[model samples]
Target: MLRNSPLHPLARFLLNIISPLEGNTLSAVKNTQHFVRIIKEQHVTQQDLLVSFDVTSLFTNVPTNKALDVVKKKLSEDESLEHRTSLSLNAIMEMLNMCINTTYFQLDDEFYQQEFGVAMGPITSTQRYIHGRL
Candidate 1:
């Protein structure tokens, strides 16, 4: 169904423009510099003891299903659809459908499949923007 959709390219273009602003390479460099500065200022030594923790599947825990449900409910409740012309409503519906269908899969057979729908309304992209696979 998605492959037959004509609006997919437009949806992808809009997503590229609206994805989250975090995780930029420049931001990562800046963050590293700031961290080093803080360490130097605090005189934290390796012998002072360091504790590190790692999280697995951090973004996967964001409740994408819940987010998708909320978006669908809000769209259904909007009274604007009643006043808008049929053409306008159709355009909005197309975008919503595209948003709902957007997803990516992992290549490894052992990895869990990753799927995401609308996590933020039209202005924001899904949470797994920088996934290594897709």
Candidate 2:
């Protein structure tokens, strides 16, 4: 079904324009110094605990529809910030569907479509932007 969809390219294009890298709000640690400074500022104590989250293959785990719903809510709330972005929430959501819903993979020479789950890679930050708010 998705393989024949004509809007797919348009969707991807819109997604590219609205890509999250353009507005990275994260103060991503660039080096050991930044990591050390953050850790030092935390003032770790003997009673305090350290934690690490494992999101390996996390993209395949997210339910596409539910995540999309969350993205919709986020978009609605952030509508006031629309001046920063040209695409409407509807356009972004539509592109998101076309981007993630049509994922196809090969197995022993056969191709199968992924009906659910968000695709990984460039879409990762978008996923974080939507989910991190919750």
Query: Using lDDT as the measure, which candidate wins?
Result: 2
TM-score for each model = 0.30, 0.56
Backbone clashes (count) for model 1 = 0
Look at candidate 1 and tell me the lDDT of residue 100.
51
Per-residue lDDT tens digits for candidate 1, residues 22-62, read 24334253556786775676667678986657755444455
Model 1 lDDT-worst window of ten: 117-126
Q: For model 2, how does the per-residue alpha-carbon lDDT over 1-134 read when each residue is reduced to its tens digit?
A: 23345555676565554544333345567667977887887777799999866657676678889977866775666634466567777877887776767665444465545544665543343443333211
Question: What lDDT does the true structure give each of the candidates?
Answer: 0.46, 0.60
Scored against the true structure, residue 86 in model 2 reaches a CA lDDT of 76
Candidate 1 lDDT (Cα, whole model)?
A: 0.46
List ranges where model 2 is wrong by over 4 Å: 1-12, 21-35, 79-81, 84-86, 121-134
